[model samples]
Target chain A: MKENYDIVIIGGGPAGLAAAVSAYDNGAKNILILEREPRLGGILNQCIHNGFGLTRFKESLSGPEYAYRFIKEVEARDIDVLLNTTVLSLEDNKTITAINSEYGVFSITPKAVILSMGCRERSRGALNIPGSRPAGIYSAGTAQKYVNIKGYLPGKRVVILGSGDIGLIMARRMTLEGAKVLAVCEIMPYSSGLRRNIEQCLNDFNIPLYLNHTITKIEGTSRVTGVVVSKVDENKQPIEGTEMHFDCDTVLFSVGLIPENELTKGAGIEQSRNTRGAVVYQNRETMIDGIFACGNVLQVHDLVDFVSEESEIAGACAANYVLNGRQEHNPISCINGDNISYVLPQKIDKNIPGNVKLFFRVRNTFKHCKIVVESNGVVLQEKKKLICVPGEMETVILSSDVIAKAEGDIVVRLEC
Target chain B: MNKQLTCIECPMGCLIEVEVENGAVKSVKGNTCLRGKMYAENEVICPLRVVTSTVKTVSGKMVSVKTDKPVRKSEIFEVMKKINSLTLDRNVVIGDVILANIDRDANLVATQNYND
Candidate 1:
């Protein structure tokens, strides 16, 4: 095996696969992808439902299909892929300590590194729902894997908590598999899933969606027997008398996803408190000279297309860092203001002479609002949006000239 | 008759109202694009969706598959039954036809390779 490479992309999911392909296409030949999973497709292998790749492929494809396209592209270019390789530690100096069954513990120092380790679903422990720790309670993603990949039904009666895409999709999936989906309870006033999913998954199947509600208690001893649902007030505190019990056998939690950044944390990379991922510049390069990050590792993205797009930038930037030496540039911090929760590429390198797309999510739902970007007390750009939700990600592009001329922090705010 | 539907043509998901007369779409309103109008009309006439599910392989591993074309919405459960009952006895790659002529104008095709 090669001891050194121009670029090493961690996590062979859609993000890493796309990054490797993009890096190879842009003159980085000696690139390798390290995937912890036995398969190269990552979580896409378990996502059997369609409605992916509409932006990148122009056709609705299943998750596996979308991932296979990139896998095929990587294979065609003869890009090196190491599967079942778990990366243990990532050093600040671009050294990756990895281990595999075939090859024992080994250290590889690439010229540059791209972190694409995607996010994981929030588990029951995080929710802290009052309950007897028992069987039949699974994360929506874990249940998805059991049903879609392992061909096993988790339970006959299911109660899904959270109206996110996976929970909604599983509501339909469990129904198709002959399970009675009692209800989908969301803690928020608005669903954290796409409207299309709500329409197609829950609405089409006649499953009731309870908004501004949460599970008050789990009533079961050996397994999940039922759950008590209750409405929450403005402060997210459960209304005492609103508790309603529903008898169910299974409980699926679809709360949220957290970016897997243990390696980044280990490397002592600067992280965003909002995104829970690495803080990076417009080029997706972290504060560290040769290290970069993209995809869900930087911030959890709604669509794989956006992940591919972001990783492409990271891949290109890493390749440039290896081929051409690192360039010194004046950088400005990007600040999230008002209703805006967080913005990606938290910093903009003024030296990069191109438009930088700032992707962000609102803290709450709003209708008919304008996204305003300001820098140096000057309004650089503003765009109107009819509706905005935390579930759906939004993007605005800023010209390099605007970033370069900025003397203060770049601020993105929503004016309703 | 008046029918309300959401246009799934794109992410906009316009709320479309369709007026149906004599089993035909008379008009579609509140749709922002022609695709939405067409979608409303088709949804009023006959809703269709691509069915995705997994079939057991010879090695006992489940392989994900989907219809090559849209299946009539009314027959989704029926098609799903057919899909659930099916079991492939050989290795298959993506795009391999698992079942031919599944429902109206549809073929069950593998979305991922099952080497095992």
Candidate 2:
């Protein structure tokens, strides 16, 4: 195996796998995927639920299923996949220093790098719930890994806070494993999970979903004793005299997901505060010509299918960059105006072929909505959707014909 | 029967009410689809369900597995008993038969991602 390759992908999850395969298909022969875990699949291994692969497969499949499709593609393509390896540091010169027993602290200087480190689950400490820092408090992702992937129940009685997908899935998973879920408390009036998840994971399980409520404090010592939950006002401040205690052994927090951008940030990439991700080109390339990002590391995707879908673009871009050098000019900026969380591909080169696709998410869920892409108040294209949720991503197509006409900055906005 | 049921045929989530007379559906209402009306009729007599959850595995993921045929509303526990007795050996693929002949006809199958 060569130390230096055309591409160096940071994570070997679905994103890296798809990217590697796509890179191979798109002309880059020497591509490498470095993952920290012993296995390639990242969070998908623990997801274990359906609702993934709807877009990519056109049929519903579980998380692992969706991941295996990409994994199989990479395997079939004979892509280099390195497990139990972590990229220690990345430099401005596209040099990656990675360590593994097989390749101990090797320096690989690739022409380009794709960052797909994925996101990390926010823990209890980040929530600042005033209480004793004790055991039996785990992030929903940790507990999920324990039960779904590791085959060990986290607890017999659990109270999960935050209704993100992992928390909702865990609520049902814990129930089926013979544990009594006290309740799922959400600080907001609505769950952050997909509406389908709320219906399938909680409503079907007969679990009580307390909206506009939260766990004010955790009461535990060595292990876990109980928890103090309370109702809150619109500002999420606990209502006085509304604190209630539930005798549960575990408290799981699924607060939110933070994209792991240490390397991207360290590399001096321009990121968006709204998306908490890097502002990239249509090719998923950051302002740094040779660098790219995809998957949860780019933005927390509701389904793994979209991750696989996006990785292809990143991989193809990296491969194209390695093969014929990236085109540098004719960049058209992408803007996210009101109601839109953020837009990927912050810019696009007019020289590119075909229509460009921009993926984004909304701040709130809407039953019926329109996503409009415009240039200087001139609506370029508009898409109407019957149902749109914040958990699910929305994409708009900007045709090459449209790009040919883009005289000014392209702005993407969502309307209810 | 003194219970109300919702049709899960689709995302419509049709709320349907049913009344049973002489162990059979006597009246059904609030169903938006023909399938929902039929579901209301059958639910009063022999309620069918689509059970989804993870099953124990020897060395694979604790991924979702669905019964080829939904268990009888009253036989969910019995079906689970049978499902518990069986084990998924290593190298089980998706759609692999983990517990065949579940109810003389149905098969308990792996629905999650796996490789044989």
Candidate 3:
């Protein structure tokens, strides 16, 4: 109904909602959230699981609950919400072209923009699973969405090919509703999901989890009926003699998640193959002026609360941009070093908030290591932790005071 | 004291700053509408959450289920008490309402993909 204004947020997930809310709180009043789904809620609609909202709200809430909290916040604010609206592209300094079934197509030039389109699942095609093209094969996330949100059962007896979080969760999910989960097979020796999930969701249920294994063959005609699982060696090569076959109607693949960056890429933002995402500043701002990204669109996080936190930062910054028009703050280079997989803030600014949370992931599992944050190779700050696992994301907070003193680039590295 | 409130209604997360003056909400600030205000007030007091997770089944599968409606956030662990006590009957379909009464009020619905 309205023409153009302050902020235009893409995707109606938790990140988009948080960005819109935080932007308004910081004084960017004119805001709009465009969601492609029939309604808001995004992936949380299908998540239907707990372990959410622990950080944002002291209570453990489900995905829907976490999303609803922000949804409720967005409704309270005067931010315009446009659901069932798909953003076609972004061009020419945050100019947006989007369409909804009800409203044809429209273009808007927002002063500031936030992108929270989330991510996508690695389908069976992405995984060279070396099997027949079958009807029963389904991505664990897709199966989850249909089963949990859309209220459709995907299979009867299932063999999950990957031990990712969604697959692991689905293993337990299918079992609860009276389906027999034969086994959860993982290619890598180590599981990609959180350890607690393995112990509680799979082990407690008396389900077998086969590590260092891969699904060799899928057997079925018009429907799925059987699958062959083979053991893998140290290098993850499938061993010949270790092949085991099972009779099952469904095969769920829980391989991996990929950031949805078609819009980001089309925007011509600088991207890194390592992260598969556009390089952004400390404030979650993309390389382009007045454009920002957060949540899975920026980085994949194990917990939605971190997504909420990052989106809040993105939201506040977008609001600041609307109110103050292009912040003139000193920048500090951010780098990943040592065992550190990657540092979130590719760069930093002088006027960061009092509690600035820097998110990152580790290269591999490590125990009792020191995470040192350095400036110009000098140890500025370091924290020792008992455990750091690649499955779980790590966050370090440096007070605004410490950030103000930084002159050159900042580096995060892991040391013994 | 009226705590500034925002609706946690849907994923929209309507931000409303509510003013609570004497242990009671005085006025809500920054919400789009009344739905958001009521949502924020409810969030301040009895925030409800749904529980969807895996439960052990005799068939060696993990069945996912959720409380039919949202339950009090404080009652999540308690509600799981009922879920822990539950065992699926043979041939249960997806989207079947597993337990309609959780702690006497919460409704638990079975997920669609239960090994099928």
Candidate 4:
């Protein structure tokens, strides 16, 4: 391992692999990718289901296949990858401390650093569901790894909690593997997962989806035996006299994902409350100079195609920072308006060349609405949409001319 | 017969209603794009799905594989049975055919490279 490099990307998942390839292609030859896993592909190795790379490859590919495409690109470029290495700390001075069996307690000072560490599943401890800590409970992704990677079934009868995409997919997977999936309960009225998953994974298998419901109590000892699901009111509080019991041996939690930002926090970098990640500019450069973040570490993207695209921006910009140095520009804040959950690239460089794409999500479902991008009471762009749901993300582009004409902060909102 | 279906072609998930008469799609409505319309028509007439699963290798490691093309939805379990019972004894790369003609016209190919 080299003591110095041009760029060091943490986390060798789809984001890290794409970033390394892009950085190499953009003339940053000396780059290294640090991966904690034994292999290059991160979570993609266990994601055996298809429906990936639709936008990027224009073909429905399984997770491993999608990852292999980028992995091959990185290999062709001869990028350096450190497997089974975990980064311990990231300092603001572009210094990374990592450890592995090959290199014990080493530090590398790269000219630029890119953080591609993805998100993690919300665990049972985070949910605080009143239940006994049983052996049959597992996160949806853990169950996926168990069945797809280890070739072991988690349980015979399963009741999945929270209708996230992983849970919905596992509903079909367990059923196909000959296990009986009892029910999928979601406390929210609307499922956070993609509508396509609900169709293919749950609807096709005739799995029951209980919306506005949550597990009120878990009844089990050494192993899971049953669960009491209760309906929630408009405020998401469980109501009385609406408990439904299901006899099952396992319970899978797929509530939500939180960006793994412990290293980001340790670096004292500015964080965004909306994305739970680092605050970055249009080029994905973070508040700290020469440091960048992309993929799930910047924002939890719905599709891997978008993750690759965003990581490319981060990679190219990191290369630019290494080669040409940081350019001087005024920063413009992008804020979420009414009904807008969050907008990314929280800050945009006013003097940036070309257009900037702002990705965002809606707070709730809206029909026949107009998405308006405005600055200082002047409408920059407006588009009509048939429907907008929180499940799917939305993107809008802002031309350089409109950005130059901005008088104050840019705001994105949904107007009915 | 009028049937309701959700277009899985994209993330939009437009709800499409299809009218079928005499085993043919009479009309498709509520799709926002051409792909959605085609999906609705094909779904109402004959539903098809691409099956993906993992097969055991000679070393007892799991290697991901998938159908090369969409097959009859009703034959998914049959295709899975064929995939489950087979194990690869030789090393394989992506796109290598693990089971030829697993279905009528679809081939089960390795989605990931496995060396055993």
Candidate 5:
């Protein structure tokens, strides 16, 4: 391994692979991708379901197939990659400390670094469901890895806890594999998963989706035997006298995903309270110069197609930072307005050229609403939508002319 | 016959109402796009879906595979049975056909490269 390089991307998932390829294509020849997995594809290896790459490729592809497109691109570009290598630390000075079986403790000082470590599913402990430490309990993603990668079924009868995409997909998967799916309970009234998944994965299989319900208590010892499902009130507190019982062996938790930002935090980078990831600019560069983040590490994207698009921006910007040096940044804060959960590229550099795409999600479901972007009481952009749900992310573009005329912090909100 | 279906063509998940008369789709409503209209029509007449799953290699490793095209939804389990029973010992790359004519003209192809 080289002691110095132009760009070092952490994680070889779809994000990292696409970043590396984009960096190489944009003039940075010396680039390296460090993947902790034995292979290049990260989470995509275990995501065997189709419905990926719809926007980018304009064709529905499986996770591995979507990843293969970028992997093939990386191979064709002859980009360097180190599999089974875990990055130990990332310093503010753009230095990376990594370790692998081939090489012991080593360090590399790259001119620019791109973080694409992705996100992890919120496990049972995170959910704090009153349950026994049973053997049949597994996170939805873990169950996916078990069934899709290891070729082992987690259990025969399953009761998924949350209606996240992974849980919804597993509902169908376990059923197809000859397991009996009892129920999918979600505490929230609306599922965080896409509507398409709710239609295809759960509705198609005739799986019961109990909204406003949660597993109140888990009854099991060495293995899962059953769970008590309870209905929740508007405040999400379990109500009395509304208990349902299900006899199932496995309980899969698919609550939510948290961005893996250990290294980002270690680097002392500013973090976003909403995304739980690094606070980046329009170009995806973090507070620290030359250190950038994209993909799930930046924001948990609903589609891999957006992950690829965002990582490409990070990759290209990192290359520019390496070749042309740092450009002037006139900071413009983007405030989350009413009903807006969070907006990405938390801050934008006004000096950057071209239009800017601001991605965000609503706090709740709204019908026949208008998304408006405002700065200093002047409307920059506004668009009408038939419906807006927290499950689906929304984006609005701001032209350079409107950005140039901005006088104060920009705000994005719903104008119902 | 009147049927209600959700358009899976995109994330919008348009709740479509289809009017079928004598086993033919007469009308589709509530779809936001052309694709949703087509999807509703096809779903009413004959539904199709791309099946993706993992097949075991000789080395006991799992290699992901998918149908090259959408197959009849009714024959998904039959296609999966064919996929589950097949075992390959040869090296294969993405787009390589693992099983041909598994569902009509839809070939089961490898989604991930496996070398053993």
Candidate 6:
């Protein structure tokens, strides 16, 4: 390990690997990737399902296969990778404090740092589900790890809650593993999972999906025995006399994902109120001079392809900041208008002189919608879509000419 | 008879309606792309899907594997049975064929590496 390096990426997942490769390609020869796992492919190792890399590779690939493509590149370029190393903190001066079993506590002051610690699933405790603390409850991702990586069956009968992508995928995965999947319950009318997953994972398997319903109570003393599900009203409160019961041994929670940004917050970096990650510019550089962030650590992405694209921006910009001091650029704030939940690259540097892709998601489901980007009532760009859902992400590219025409904050809105 | 299906060829999940006469696809409508049209026709005739799963290794670890191509959707369970019954005799690397000619020339290959 060197005392000083050009760039240090905190995670070894798809984002970290891609960022390191991009940094190296951009002339940052001395770069290091810190991965807490024993291997390079982070969450992808356990994500054994296909449907990854559709946009980036132009082919549908399994999670591990998509990650291996980048892992091979990183190995070919002779990039430095430190596995089984956990970064404890990031200081304000770009110093990283990390530790591993092989090496004791140590700190490295890098010229630039990239934060790629991905997000974590929201557990049952976070959901506030009233239930006895049983042994059969596991997060969808945790169950995925056990079944796909450890070769262990977590349970025999499963009932998934919250209809997220991971939960929907696990519904099919658990079913294929010879487990009886009774039902999948969602509190909202619409599912947060992608349309393909809902159709393929759940619909194909004949597993009943109950929308506008939630788990009212978990009835298990030692292990999971059953759960009481009830339909919820418009306000999300369970309606009386609308309860249904299922006999299942396990309950899987797929409520949502929370970005792992404690280190970013502890370092006193500016955080986005919506993304809960570091507020970054179009180049993915955070408010801190050389600290950049991308991937799930920046914003939870629906596809790994988008993660790779965002990390490349972070990696390239981090390299530029290290080689040439932060270049002079004027900042233009990008705001989320009506129906828009959140917009990435919260601020764009107009002087960057190129096209910048801004990714965002809608707050709800809409049909026949026009996504428009405008500034000071002047439309910059518009795209028509047949349908837009909160589960899938949408991107809009802003050319330099359109950006230059902005006299005030740029607004991205959905015009119905 | 007519059937409605969502075209999963790409992210644009277009709702396609297929006209069937005596179990044969007569026409595929409402699809925006050529791939979607093909998907609707095949779905009505015989659907196929890529199956991914993990097999037990000799070292007591699991190695993820997937079909080289889509297999008959109706035979997914049968193919999974073939996959679940096998225990690797030796360690294999990614892209190594675990089972060949599985359900219509689809090879089951390793997607993950397990080092003992």
lDDT per residue, candidate 4, A1-416, as tens digits? Answer: 76679999999998998899899999899999999999997888888888899889887889999999999999898678999999999999978999999979899999999999999999999878897887999999999999999999999999999999999999999888889999999998899999999999998888999999999888898999999999999998999999999999999999999999999999999999999999999999999999999999899999989999999999998998899987896899999999999999999998668899999999999999999999988998998998898988899999898888888999999999
Candidate 1 local lDDT, A212-285, one digit each (tens): 99998998899989999999999999999999889999999999999999999999999999999999998899
lDDT of 5 by residue, A1-416 (tens): 77679999999998999899889999999999999999897999899988898788888888988888898899999688999999999999988999999998899999999999999988888767886798899999999999999999999989999999999999988888879998999999999998888988888878999999999999999999999999999999999999999998999999999999999999999999999999999999999999999999999999889999999999999999999999989999998999999999899898789999999999999999999999988998899998998988899999899888889999999978
Q: Flag regions of model 1 displaced more than 4 Å.
A: B32-34
Q: Specify the poorest-scoring 10-residue window by lDDT in model 3 chain A.
A: A195-204
How accurate locally is residue B96 in candidate 4, as Cα lDDT from 0 to 100?
97
User: What DockQ, on C-alphas, does every prediction get?
Assistant: 0.71, 0.29, 0.07, 0.79, 0.76, 0.71
Give me candidate 4's TM-score against the actual structure: 0.98
Candidate 6's displacement at residue A372, Å, is: 2.7
Worst 10 residues of 6 chain B by lDDT: B6-15
Q: Model 4 - which docking category?
A: medium
In model 6, pairs of residues that clash are none
lDDT at A415 for candidate 3?
A: 89
- State the fnat of candidate 3 relative to the true structure: 0.11
Clash pairs for candidate 5:
none
Candidate 4 C-alpha error for residue A50, in Å: 1.4
lDDT of 6 by residue, A134-249 (tens): 88999999999999989999999999999998999999999999999999999999989877788889988999999999999999889999999999999999999999999999
Model no. 5, DockQ = 0.76
Q: What is the lDDT of residue B40 in candidate 5?
A: 91
Could you estimate the TM-score for every candidate? 0.98, 0.87, 0.80, 0.98, 0.98, 0.97
The model with the greater TM-score, 2 or 4, is 4
Candidate 6: where are CA atoms >4 Å away? none
